[model samples]
Target: MSRRRHENFRELLSKREGFTVSQVSFQNEVLEAHNYYRDLHCAPPLQLDNKLSRSAQIFAEELASKNQFYHSNTKGVGENLYMASGSNVDSLTGKLSSNQQISSSFSYANIAGDAPVTDWYNEIEQYDFDYPGFSGATGHFTQVVWKNSKNLGVGIAYTSEGDSVYVVAQYTPPGNYQDQFPDNVFPEGQC
Candidate 1:
């Protein structure tokens, strides 16, 4: 099939399968979210790196295509991945009424554009500021605000079945190294 025709067919199939394909790039949203959290931690802002973004995008697409969730083996970079399914509910006002019954079917609601970043940043709640250290639970949060991580890259993709979405973000000069956590990840408001 011609590329255009194939694209149209895929779109039609997605709709029929209860998946709304989103081509929206969450780059800006992701960047803003990262900087927002970084600022709170008194870390300098990170600039977006195109090469890293491309690499991240490729990995994200691979995860989506294979319907798998795992970290990439790419060296020399810190990575974070997020996968979520169900309706693309809005963060602020997507709450369902108590009386509302949940449905197994999916809705066409657009995916929460900033969900991945939000979820990653939310890990801060579990982070201990007084004793900074590396922990699987708070790694994502730490990478976002890692003081020495100066470059950022973000990528997002949806599963082939359209039932899930995956987000991948990479950081330069990766963070969370042993014995360096105290210096790289600082207490809130302490640069």
Candidate 2:
């Protein structure tokens, strides 16, 4: 483990969670025990604390209209292997394919799609303050991903939807948000 690299990682970790000089040094020592920071990819460090939110204009009548989806891909492992030793003959061969395996998953949410979208949206917007669950404790949020070569990412979302006002808490990552080091367990790979 290079002392310089260890020291650098220590510096970054210190900025995380307000670590004291001694704590930073101690963690660095622990990290060095396994050379955990050796394979750390410094470029585009992993994003650890990513929060997402989104909202759309739905008719008040469409109160029951709702949908949500999640997707994921697991790759990097070698191809699957099968063993064969039947009566005909005994042989060993490698099974490989150019394309990465893809598995799809889906989830469906039922929304009250029968309501008048315009009236519902306007009603929610106007009476959001008076709306019991829609105010203070509830609100709307938004999340958008721009399609650019840079893959520029920006998230603007709401957490607590409010009453007749339907006020929302600003979705901002904690100032401590930073790229993960060493493990990079939470890599934000291309979608």
Candidate 3:
């Protein structure tokens, strides 16, 4: 490329929004968080899959660049997505109310690295082990602890403007099968 073109390209790149590729530490944080929750339900730990990670990363980038939220079209892979925006970059914490309701508190700042995974796991409060089945509200939690899901891949991207974050987690041998919930999603403390 010519010098002028090279300078112009650099300028364009600089104007682009900032995106954070999943680093080793961030990946570990997500994995550990999932395992912690999985253990509660007696599910085994999940291994990280590179191929799924790459696919998830690509989708995460797309979502961040476009500032949109949606699931990927990848067939047969279980997926979860989370997006949060604010001025406060600290961790977001929530709790179930006395009536078993989700009460959330928001602050101004960017989202913390592991907050998305925690948020996804918190859906457990809505999951019913006795009537194990798919529900939009608890799908993310079920996917995290699905015994049939042996592999996991996660991707995260921060919006170019640094005001939001998008998280994607993909699973192999996906969970939430209509007839397989009984076998895949077990009661807590039962393997």
Question: For candidate 1, lDDT tens digit of each residue in 1-191?
Answer: 45466456645543442222233235666788888888888888898887787678778878877888999999999999988755432342144333443222222233454677778888989998888888999999999889899988776666545556677899998998888888888777876
Q: Number of clashing pairs, model 2?
A: 29
Local distance difference test scores for all models: 0.72, 0.19, 0.71
**Model 2 misplacement above 4 A:** 1-104, 107-123, 127-134, 141-170, 173-191
Deviation (Å) of 172 in candidate 3: 0.3
Cα lDDT for residue 122, model 3? 84
* Total clashing pairs for each candidate: 0, 29, 8
- Model 1, residue 143: C-alpha shift (Å): 0.6
- Candidate 2 matches the true fold with a TM-score of 0.13
- The residue pairs in collision within model 1 are none
Give stretches of model 3 more than 4 Å off: 1-22, 91-113
lDDT by residue (57-77, candidate 2, tens digit) is 111102211111211121211
TM-score of 1: 0.76
Worst ten in a row by lDDT for model 1: 101-110
Q: What tens digits encode model 3's per-residue C-alpha lDDT throughout 39-112?
A: 88888899888778767777886897789998999998999898866543224423212243211111112224
User: For each candidate, what TM-score against the reference?
Assistant: 0.76, 0.13, 0.76
Candidate of highest lDDT = 1
